[model samples]
Target: MSDANWKVAAERDLMSLGGRPRLFESGSGSYVTDDAGREHLDFLGGIAVNSLGHAHPVFVSAVAEQAAKLAHVSNLFASQPQLDLAARLKRLAGTGEDGRVFLANAGSEANETALKLARLHGNPRGKTAILSLAGAFHGRSIGALSITPKAAYQDPFAPLLPDTRTIEPTLDALEHAFAADDVAAIFIEPIQGEAGVRELPDGFLARARELTRRHDALLILDEVQTGSGRTGEWFAFQLPGMLPDGELPDAVTFAKAVGAGFPLGGLITFGRASDLFAPGMHNSTFGGNPLASHVADRVLAHVEDEGLLANVTRRGAQLREAVSALPGVSGTRGAGLLIGIALERPIAADVVAHALDGGLIVNAPAPDTIRIAPAFTVGDPEIEDFIRRFGDALNAASQSSETTA
Candidate 1:
């Protein structure tokens, strides 16, 4: 097995849709070493899922210990870890004492549960239309995909959920959508991750809260990529000016970093929405298994005890400033570790490829935007390394562009 060629083995035994050439053999902190012995700075952080970074001692110990104690128990019977994780998330959400959590396997399932809750909550009021912003990417499941605004991803499965509509993320668009009085719920990402890490304009989210309340519509913040302390806060909606003064979202969805690489996601419902899911309304087999729940709990506890949120804030600003100062970068966007580099030209893909070749991991979510979500445990050294290598990658990309042109 040690001598097995990853590329050849992948091509032979796995699906072709999502294969990467380099086989990561080991990882720690902010770096991963490939089978070929190349150590790469990992800024992608498993697409923002590895909140604490690779092989953190706490994360490893929690999972191992939980697995030994009790890994799975049917939802019919509760586990301590599962219940504790729920309570912890609700507190972090700042929802009222009555707040409730519905656990699922990943972001998609969490959002699917939210959609169901929205439908159930809206049916009695005769409000059925689901509204989404034009640039939102909720998930890939049929229910979540129905609200996702990307036609390229949605068109393949045409004739999606009925009564679904999309509006731009502008005040005017919100006003226009609210005028109809038929919207049941509005799903949005505080920072559009896949659409190039674009932040929802300040005051716009607060205004959405006001409008949704005025219209008796549910405002659901999809914090899948921005939650669990990724944005220098437990949730993006918790950031100042995100919600109306002294107000909270109707519901919020979380995943990715919540489990810190383990498979766990959930929705926290506030106020009356918390009671929308009746008995047997929604459930998951592996949603809140003791192993995943315990791991997530440990991750969250460590996040607080170690003050990773403050670190995220500091590292984010440092990384963004450094990256934005690089050649070919026009600007930077996003908050905390969820940073995006706006390239001066439409060569994000080229930059990403060059960066990978230069032993730095990054991703191009849009033609002109390179996204980076390093681990919460990242330090000045890793950030510095990324900047140096990324600069070289950008130069390489520039050279390639000039040659091609």
Candidate 2:
């Protein structure tokens, strides 16, 4: 579609993420074109979904060829592409046994499926409560939303799904949750995304694994934002340097860049715990469809063939070091592509807008923090350019605020 056609978007629907009146026309590598044909060095990578950057020949061909061949086949049927993608995911996860995959359209639905699995797993043991970490975000559906933190997002939809609880302040909350009689699952992000890239405590994931085992509760890792090589490895939890013990979660939910700009999400589980749900228990109409899974296969294959994992490791460290060295940047958080730069104050939103004007695209996941999850394929030049442009944005933010005062 042409960029001039975007004005019609406002007239058609008022959905979110449209604040910028500017429209994007096309992209190549890590750069994008606005309606006016101004080029932008994109650093956000569509908020971590565009793993390979724009117009990667591999992704374009994968989607186009699959679309021309077969786009949709109901869940009742199986397609070769879908099966192959599932096998690849299982292999990446190192699930030696037949670890089943439940494909869906997006990350939220992915979490919903995992939540349902947990419920079914606990049904036999009479477990009902779902425990989630404070500042955690799973999804928006009542089922996924029930476990998500941030009352601002949840309060409006008060009286959400029942048997859900959030914990913060201390292990007391988690302990109380674990001790509860009706506990079923513990859903948590290995590294919190919207909550300032807040990482899970050291030895805590291992502890949660132990606690869930003790209570016979299922532990679901909401890796939607952290999985699929985003964190310099196949999964953040499995990243050797990130965690002290190098722990692994029972079940993992993935979406975002796993499909590399394709709309696909998946739920993976290990051991007998994954076999909780039987046929007819849960299904997605578009689940395991050809187009999405085919692109997913290509995304994984490209990541491996191009050795993007190692690239992410090197680039992520370089980016973090640069961010930490910035004037007002206080600290850097998150592993690999999922990075958050903490500012001294709430200048993140201002910096984001300024960055847009300075030919760089970034996002403010929190008021005082700027999040950067650029494409793993983004090279050294783009990384250096990003830091240079970002420094101007930060300086502009500081200067503008001073003038307003």
Name the top TM-score candidate: 1
Encode model 1's per-residue lDDT on 1-405: one tens digit a residue: 343666678789888978475788899998999877889999999999999889999999998899889999878889999889999999999986989998888999999999998899789999999999888999999989998988788999988899989999899988899898988999989999999999987689988888889999999999999999999999999888787667999899999998888988989999989878879878998888899899999999999999999999999999988888888899999999999899998998899899999999999999999999999988978988999999999999988999999
Instruction: State the C-alpha lDDT per candidate.
Output: 0.91, 0.85
Candidate 2 segments exceeding 4 Å error? 1-12, 16-18, 169-172, 241-247
Alpha-carbon runs more than 4 Å astray in model 1: 1-5
| Worst 10 contiguous positions by lDDT, candidate 1 | 1-10
Per-residue lDDT tens digits of candidate 2, residues 1-405?
455566676657766744755678899999999878899998888878999999989999998999999999799899999989989998998776757788898889989988888888787888888888888888888878888877877898889888787887245566677776677888878888888888866666766777887888887888899999999889877876434453456688999988888889979988765678788988899988999999999989999998999999889999999889989999999998889899988888899889988988989888999988889897789988998999999999989888987
Q: List the residue pairs that clash in candidate 2.
A: 129-182
